[model samples]
Target chain A: MIHVVRKLFWDFEKEEQWLNEMSAKGMALTHYSWCKYVFTETPKNEYTYRIELLDNVPTHPESIAYIRFLEENGVECVSSYVRWIFLRKKSSEGAFDIYTDLESKIKHFKRINTLWNSVMWLEFIVGLANILIGVTNYFNSSSSISLVNVILGGLLILLGLVFLRAGAPIRKKIRKLQQENLIRE
Target chain B: MPESSERGALTEAVFYILLSLYTAMHGYAIMQNVKDLSHGRVDLGAGTLYGAINTLLEKNWIRAVEGEEGSRRKEYEITELGKTVIQGELIRLGELIANGKRIAGGESK
Candidate 1:
């Protein structure tokens, strides 16, 4: 079964939960395209999944090397898209989770926060630009279709606001990790 | 002096990594060494090991060596600087153990 989810800035926890839910339903993710995840039927909860943000997957030599290493260590490489790799290993009592210690967990959260922040920055700038351009055209146009510009401007501004609002929760999680880590050190 | 100051304290991962890489060892080998040395108490996940390797490389505490291409067989060895850092870590650890022992039992005269 293939499910399409359009989440522009999907944070780590949400993505992990969705994947785990799908896995629990006996659908193993075999591939991903943009926002679509393609799954194949398997035994319910056959494997536990992990999603990692790494650059240059299935193409770059280093990424290939890393994947090969994991496969050798009993992890299966199910799919990859953009900077994300979806991995799963047979469900067991042994550690299937990628992060085992506090330091690594902290680093993983920091990486996730950095990636999302960069994407949100780009989205905000584009949204602002679209609204400005649309509003300018709306006021300057003498044509009957000038109302179209107003609608488009409003939509762009709303979309930008949505993105900005979505980013706050993830940033709060990252900040909490940062502060907690400092206290531990 | 600057390297020592910049490196600060070694995390267990970094400490065990340097210890394991006395000979050129790949990722799995290093993980195995750490787990074995710590009597199976310390285990390094693939992700954790990968992140630690990158950090060590960036700081020049470790350097990649020749390995068969396309294998997790990407081997690394500790640099001279890495050895010095390990030595410093051992001294610090010794001091810590000594202080703890004094509290646990009686102080050595």
Candidate 2:
């Protein structure tokens, strides 16, 4: 059985955890898309999932080579969308953790934070364009479509702001790690 | 006039990884070697190992080599610069260990 679920943008970490929980309930993620996941049934707790932020272009040769390298190291590249990739390994093999120490953790979090910042900028640009179009339509045609466009543009900007805020937890974690490094020093 | 950033103190993971490359080995083999050499204490998680390998490659501390006997995986071996750095690291570690023993042994008191 394939299960479908919708997750919000801010829920990246939470959604990874939830998918693993579903694995424990006999499901493995076979496919994924923005805000949507397709999991097929499996033996309970057979796999463990991990999310890694892809800091390179997805279609780059090096990126493809790195994915192949991971496969050779026993990690299955299940699916990826934009800046994140979902990787899983058999539970019997061991944990699926990649970044174990604080320094690497900080770097990882920083990458994720960069991804969110890029997304926010993209959304803000699109929203601005939409509002400009709306204003032009209002002056040119004086139609209801202008009012609708304006509302849609405003909503997009609001969504962008929310995603910008979604980066807070990652930033907070980076700060904590830096503080620990200071203490250790 | 100045040394490279790679000449400074290496992190624990990087240190072990470079040491493991004394013999040409692939990712998984290096991970296992580090664990065994460190008496199971210095385990390299896959992600950490991956990042460390890339950084080391960028620093020219290690290079990818063809595996022996038709193996397919990318094997890595330490470069000449890596050897010099590892020697420096060992001397630093030796001094640290000596100081730690002297303080704990109460020889000065």
Candidate 3:
């Protein structure tokens, strides 16, 4: 049976609402003391498996908690796609199945990166426009444009550049996640 | 209870999934709806779409309607809560458009 856990990055209240709703719909859920949602598909033999779904990137504490949990339990935790799963010593077939799932996750992350790149292009254009607005206002002899506007525009340009810069890190994280799956295989 | 503006912070992927399910629709159908709505500008990858759908279901903004049991192509509908959220978004967008129109008019003759 499949298991699901969630480490939310977005609004905690919204996340709680989501967990409650999902639980109401017959999902087996165990709300941990921290912001971890542990769910299992069906009770099997001594061997059990679990998965986690997180909307936003988890905090360092949450990450450490998750890793530590797996390490202490001796369960092999693999993160692929957006969900990370814990696997126990099961049949060879189960191992093969897990690998397939990880591979599929890698494919999904690639698609996610592609979409992010598109957003980055849009941010870059918006940033460039802001910079131009600032530069044009500064160069203009007319005093219609306030110094504050120029400064705001410059800040906006900076923000856009930061977002544009953020795309690479996002890409790197996805690649790193994918690599984790590969290293296991 | 009245929804909070903070609650409107659904992820882009999740919001798109909810938007797609404004009508009773299945996974593939909702995916197609998003593609069409975005004029193909937004393509919801299967994994992303599935993940969003699962979260949406968990949020109660979207609920599953009757469909083939054990089938992945389960149909879903926007709840009253979901509709309220959508209305709020529409109003917000309307305000933005009106402001833009006023600004553009002021800039012109």
Candidate 4:
């Protein structure tokens, strides 16, 4: 039987862990889009799940080539949204790790950090613009505040703050890996 | 001296990649060859190999080979410049090993 789960994740690592946990309980992810995940019943620990951000969108030729390369290596691309890809390999096939070296791992985290940083800035700018619009509307009409605009603006800013908080641990991870690289690799 | 800027020590992944590409090989082949050559010491994950391949291509150290018609897997081979870089790296490694053996008093393997 198949099961559908609706959820959202800001942290890829946490999402991967949850997927693996589900797989360990005999639920293997069959598809994913936006915030919805489709799973099918399977033997316990049938597959290991990994989530990665590609350098390009899934439809891009470069991303296609990359996905094909991974497929050749016994890893399967199950689903993708934007530049983020969901990958899996059979548990009996041994460990599945995308970034094996310090440099690559650092680069991966930096990519994630860059994404969060950019989204945060975008949300902050849009939120501020919405607030300015609300203020202007209120002043011109000399009436009650534009409650909808203000509320929407506040929510956006709050979301931006959440993004900022999410980015801190990624930055810390990058720094830790870089420090290790200096002394070891 | 211009070439000297590019002559710095290659990362273990890059070094093994160039070595494996001396003969034409695809991404999966390169990964397998690296592991075998390193006696299973170095395992090239797919993502790492992809990034390294692109960087090597950008540097003109490796070129993609035309694969058989209808084949989706692309192959790559090391260029002359890549061969020269590895030659220099071999010499550098030789020096390091020789000095370590001479001073540290370990018998040369």
Task: Highest DockQ: give the candidate number.
Answer: 4
Q: Which of the two candidates, 1 or 3, achieves a greater lDDT against the reference?
A: 1
Query: Which of the numbered candidates is closest to the native, going by highest lDDT?
Result: 4
TM-score of candidate 1 to 2 decimals: 0.79
Name the runs in model 4 displaced over 4 angstroms: B1-5, B67-71, B105-109
Q: Could you give the C-alpha RMSD of every candidate to the true structure, in order shown?
A: 4.1, 3.2, 21.3, 2.6
lDDT of 3 by residue, A1-185 (tens): 43556474332224434544454454445334344656654333323233443333444565544444334323445332333332332222222121123444555445545555666566556656665765777787556664656566566556556555645654675677777865552
> lDDT scores for all predictions?
0.77, 0.84, 0.54, 0.90
lDDT of 2 by residue, A18-119 (tens): 889989999999888888888899999999998888778667787787788788889888998875788898988866777777788888889888888888
Best by TM-score: 4
Off-target runs (Cα >4 Å) in candidate 3 are A1-185, B1-12, B68-72, B104-109
What is candidate 1's lDDT per residue for A47-166, written digit by digit as tens?
A: 788888775656789888778878867788888877688888887635577776677776766666676667666666666666666667767875645456556656656665665676
TM-score, candidate number 4: 0.90
Clash pairs for candidate 1: none
All candidates: DockQ: 0.54, 0.54, 0.01, 0.70
Ten contiguous residues with the weakest lDDT in model 2 chain A: A6-15
The TM-score values for the models, in the order shown, are 0.79, 0.87, 0.37, 0.90
